[model samples]
Target: MRLFIAEKPSLGRAIADVLPKPLRKADGYIVAANGDTVSWCIGHLLEQVEPEVYDPAFKKWSHEHLPIIPDRWQLVAKRKTSKQLAVLRKLVKQADQLIHAGDPDREGQLLVDEVINFLGVSKEKTAAVQRCLISDLNAKAVKQAVSKLRSNQEFIPLSTSALARSRADWLYGINLTRAYTLQGQKAGYNGVLSVGRVQTPVLGLVVRRDQAIESFISQPFYEVWAQLETLPEDGPVERFQAKWQPSKQCQPYLDEAGRNSSKPLAENVIKRISHQPATVMQLARQHKKQAAPLPFNLSALQIEASKAFGLSAQQVLDVCQGLYERHKLITYPRSDCRYLPKDHFTEAKLVVAAITFNSGASKAATSLFGTNSEAFKSVDIGVKSRAWNDAKVNAHHAIIPTQKKLNAAKLTSTLSAIEEKVYRLICRNYLAQFLPAYEFFDVKAEISIGTGIFLAKAKEPIKVGWKCLFPSAKPKAEADNTDQESEQKIPNLHIQQGLKSLAARLDEKHTSPPKHYTDASLLAAMTGISAHVSDSELKKVLRDTDGLGTDATRAGIIELLFKRGYLRRQGKTIFSTKTGRAFVDALPDVATHPDLTALWESRLTAIHDGLSSYQELMMPLQTQLKSMVVDSRSVVPHGLRGLGSKAQYRKKQYRKKRPRKSKSSAKV
Candidate 1:
């Protein structure tokens, strides 16, 4: 009997659907007539035992048990899924051969490998153990993957690395949490302070942002603008706007950071340029091209969804998962890669055909590219594009529409509003890849008056190209804050043409503090932390390390902060609580710094690449944990100070409620 194990029930059903049937369904598994069995784990059937399970003494929080390290790790069946585990155990014991059909990632490899180990399916028990790696759940992809099964041993390094990560998190979380909670309890606090490898650093990011915002002082600044006009030979008089720039000799007042600072200087410049004749000293027009935006990786998708639909990061992930798992309309939703494999270009035609077959999408495509035109035909099939590059492809390709034909009516009827929004984004991005580049002309003009030079600029779109798909998308100038002049059309003018200023005005503006982090911006910061670091080597390391968390795990880490009351949301902005700020301030730098996470990720990568063994990777972490615990002993605990104050408030209330016995007792 052949046993096929999958990561989730949906995946198990997908695998079964591809097999030659007359399949008989069991309580928790399916059996083909040919004595083959298919079953699944609801994520993981077994999880690592808690610290208390190791030793009864470890059950209670105490500093004496600091740095609790297990000698031999243990796994216990998760209570909620114990029945599924029993089904899997019976099937594993009865099978003659086994096929591991899990997600093609480190966590996925460990999910099934751990189950097999828990079931005691040793090498001698099964005739052969094979691995199946399929990214898409469609029948064709599943069958094709089954035909090319490899040995499970090939992925042992990944499994080991994943196991090391789990244990490392446990060691840090359990030990640090106990040490801190015990310290807080001694200070008369009554709250548990939870900490973790990923959650702490993520919380640190929020705390630091809030600190910057609170300390920022707004400063008022001034700018001078002139509206000018030039009479053309035949057409209407052309008018445009320009800004004043004072020369160095004028001794223009500037802030310490070199920002323009003087209201007097701005007023003087406006007075000097008002109603004065100005010559266009320089007028340059440069044509430029912008490539289509890259396809959605999970992080990018989450950011866009947050900005466009006002959905939280977790909500976007849930909707994307539905699109991938339930509708089977997209590939994996947890991918970190934004580029497709070079060979996937061959499949692009099928995806395009699927999109063009849908009534709404077909109309949009026709309206933009013109039905029966060469441009439309090329994009509807396949074209060479920057999005297809093998070197940039990682564990999985970018989230894209699968070749499975979508039922347009079914999609609108079945999908929720947010799911439909995300699905349309995925489809539009995929269609954009085959379209021509967005072409535009960049226009800049410099006008001189006295010692000061004023400038104007504009961007004129020459071809809508891929941009037509997102008609409501903001222009680059507006999105990037390039220049206010870019929003208007630049009138035609000779290099030395003389123009008269119609009006000059001074505008008062204050330097605004940094905006609080929205889910969109925070996700960008988490994924692109390299831009924030100064060390060249560390920046490179962070870029290669995949940032703070995996796409699959980042949402959960952010959600964890909210659940623990370490972070709060005000409208779309996130802020750290007083308790959260105290927690971050009290912890050692090693515990809250993002670089520490990056370093660990680098070592994990080494393990996955066969450069280091899991033991070698873990030795340093274990040492770090021991050192951290020892260092934490000397550090003062201040995170739960609020709890102590609350206790005092409650005590005062109790005293007030007591009977007035003090006066009677004194009289007696």
Candidate 2:
């Protein structure tokens, strides 16, 4: 008998579809005619036991019992999945061969391995376990994966890395959260001042930004626009706009950003250039090409969806999960790698066909980019873009549409309005790879007028290319950065061409403070947090890592902040609450710094790559934690006061809840 353990039931069914059948549904598994069986873990069937499980004395939160470190970590079946676990234990004993089919990532690797170890399968069976990695759940992809099963032992390092991450988080969160919550209670704060390895640093970002905005003093800046008209040289006179660029001689009067800080200086430039002869000092048209943006990785998708639809990060992730598991429309939804495996290029036609017909219609009726086959008929499937690179592909390839053929009705049955929008968004980005590169001419003209240099810039589109697929986007695509810059229509002109300044327009503007964090911008900040840190050495190390959390956990961490009353949203803008600001301001640097998290993430990656061991990463963490807990005794956060206070209750106080009489009256 052969037994297959998959990460989740949806994945299990996908694996089973390509297996030997005359398959019958058993209690918690499916049995094939050949006595082969398939079972699954519901995310994780077993979890690390709580501190109380190690010793009864550590159950209460007290300064004496500060850092609860379990000497020998243990796992027990989660109550909800205990039945499924029992089924696995029975099946594992009867099987002659075993196959592990987790989701081909670090957490997926650990989920099943933890189960196998908890089930206490024999050493021989464990040693002989075969690993099957399936990123795409389509019949063809699964079949291909089945033929390429490798030894499970090869992925032990990946499992170890995930275990280290899990334990490190547990140690950091459990210890510090308790320590801080206790200190907050001492300072008369009623709520739990919860802190985590990732959540606190994220909240700190918002708190600091708010402070910066509050303290910022707006300063006036000036720019002179030259309304220049070209000389009639074998053609009708044409008018163009240009901005007065400050000369090097004007350095003393300029601000650090090279903006004209002195109003008199800017007025003088406008006065001198008002009726001056303008000669073209430089005329350059540089041809450029921009390839399509790569396919959706979880973080990228979350960020884009948030920007486009005002959908929250958690909302986008939920939609992607349904698209991956329920509809089988996309590949794995939690991948971080943006590049696709080179081999996926072979199935471009099939995937394009899926998108062109199977995907539902566009949300906006007037939008040029629709999901109908006619909309994508011009897509050249043979034109492979730079997205397909074997070396760049990580544990899982980019999230893309699977070639599971579907009709419009089937898609509508599977997707909601928001789901459809995100799905179409994913499909459009994927189809873009087959389209031609967006070609344009980068135009720059520096006008010499009365000893001052005035510059004009414009992007002349040579061909719409891939941008045609995303025409008229309301939120504006990230790749289409033309909106962020000043541009004007430019005509053919020769060097030293004579032109006259029609008029000088002085524009006075105030320097605006930084924009508040939104779901889209916050996610972007988290992914590129290296910019926030001060140390050069730490910044270099962090640049190699994804700043704060994995693609799977970032959304949840942000949502968790809101749940803990650390953040509030007013429309699309995310702000730190008074409570949140107080908590972050009082916390130590280690608890609020993203650089340390980046270092930990890099070491975990090292463990995954087999360059480091679990002990090497975990030993120092335990020692550091012990010191933090000891300090937690005297570290009463003074800022935890002045917000309306209430009684602080222990964790066990919420063991039972009063039942509501009516469904309508129930808190959702």
Candidate 3:
């Protein structure tokens, strides 16, 4: 009997539907009349246990028992999926051949291997272990995957990488969590303080941004603007405005004795303008142009959705997952590539045709350039870029609309605005790729006003180009930045039309501080391209590394921050909790610095590319982690030293406020 194992049950059923001959489906297994059988594990059927699970003595919370490292960790069935696990164990025991249909990545490999090991299946006795790679969980993908399974041995390196990563996380999570939790309890804290290889550094980012905000002090400044009107022969003066001399850049316009004015800049600019007529000094003009956005991938989608609709990373992920697994409308949802495979253009066209009739995509489809057009062929593929490597592409190409087709009417009216925006973005980019390059006319006119030079500019789209894909996608806010202006083109105007100033008004503005970290912005920052570090070589290394975590894992990492009460997002900005800030304060800056994680990532990539040994790359981190355990164990406050008196007072007030309940209200 051939037993098929998939990443999730949905995928298993998808495969079952495509198998040849008579297919019989069961609660836990599926059988084909030709005798091919399929079953699945729910994501992960087993996982490593905590240190406490190995020794009861390790269960006690005490600083003395810090760094509770386990020897020989055990793997047990995930509690909620025990029944499904039992069924899989039975099927694997009796099967002659096995097909691993889980995801085509490291974690997926581990999931299948762990199960096989648990079932005591000897590799030598098994007929074969085939790998099934399906990107979009659709009938066609599943059918195609079954016909082309590769031998399991071919995936050893990938699985090894996954195991190494998982084990490293386990070692850190288990050791540091126990170490910190025990220390916190010793210091009279009620909640467990947890840490992870990724979480600590992520929290560091939030805390640092908040400190910058709190420490910032606003400074007042002044400015002046003069308004003027011009004759119609000069084209209505184009609303002339003026800039002050060098003295205006500073606060030198004080009354007698250089005393600065207490009045606001708006009042001052108006007063200065009312005193005299403005004069023309000089005119300057320059031309500018912009290009269309590249394409959509999982990270870009999440970033855009969060900006456009205020959706959390996980929420966008869930929606995309559903779109892939249930609706079969798109491909994989965890990739970072923003470019399509060169050969996938044919498939891209079919997918576009599928959505154009139902959704607002038809208008975009009509404006699309032909697939064979030179305009579509100019995009740089960067053949040497890792992001574009064919070998790195697994089950699916990047997250793209599938040729399986789309029916916009089938989409629910209740679909989130974010979902609509992201889907449309995909369609627009795909369609734009085939369209003529968007052309624009830029007009620049310069006019001098009273010893100052000024410039004016505008852009006019000469060709709608790919922009016709989603005419409605013009500028939206907070999470999305799509609009006619965002597309690069030239403004309509000639340099020699003569000029005229219709009107001019002085405007006053304050220099604003850096904007707070929105989810989208925070995601970008965590990638660790820091300028503070003195080592240019290290900075370059960090730039080449993956930021924070992989796309497949980043949502979970952010969710972890929420779960641990380390961070929370209000609207779009992410704020660190008091506990989170305190945790950051407790850890060494360099230890939790984003640079370290970036360095680690760079080395890991080097290991993968054969530029460095895995042992050399990992040994330093392992050593650092051990030193961290020792240092943290000795130094963290024993009784909540960092939380300050507010927490204590809150606890006191809460205890004092505990009121007696009415007898009838007491259920016990």
RMSD of each: 9.4, 5.7, 9.7
- Writing each residue's lDDT as its tens digit, candidate 2 over 1-668 gives 98889999988888788878788987779988878789998888876666666666666777778787776776666667788887898989998988999988899998898888777778888999999999888888998998998999999999998999988998998889889888887888776677788898899999999999999999999888898897776388888878888878988988878888889998888889897889998999999999988898899999988988999999999998888888888989988888888888888988988876775453431242543334466789788999999888757888898888777677766678788778877887898899899899998898899788888888888887888777655554553323433346777877898899987988888889999999999999888888877678988776444578888889999998987778999999999998888888778877787777777777888888898899888888888889878877778777877552434333432222222221111000
Rank by lDDT (best first):
2, 1, 3
Candidate 1 vs candidate 2: the TM-score winner is 2
**lDDT per residue as tens, model 3, 170-220:** 777667766776566557666656677777777787788788888876554
Residue 528 local lDDT, model 2:
85
Q: In terms of TM-score, how similar is model 2 to the real structure?
A: 0.92
Candidate lDDT (C-alpha), each: 0.76, 0.81, 0.61
Q: Report how far off residue 444 is in candidate 2 (Å).
A: 1.4
Ranking by TM-score: 2, 1, 3
Clash pairs detected, candidate 2: none
TM-score of each predicted structure versus truth? 0.86, 0.92, 0.75
lDDT comparison, 2 vs 3, better candidate: 2
Off by over 4 Å in 1: 93-97, 120-128, 151-154, 229-237, 246-252, 277-283, 359-378, 473-483, 491-502, 532-537, 609-617, 642-668
lDDT score, candidate 2: 0.81
Pairs that clash in candidate 1: none
TM-score of decoy 1 = 0.86
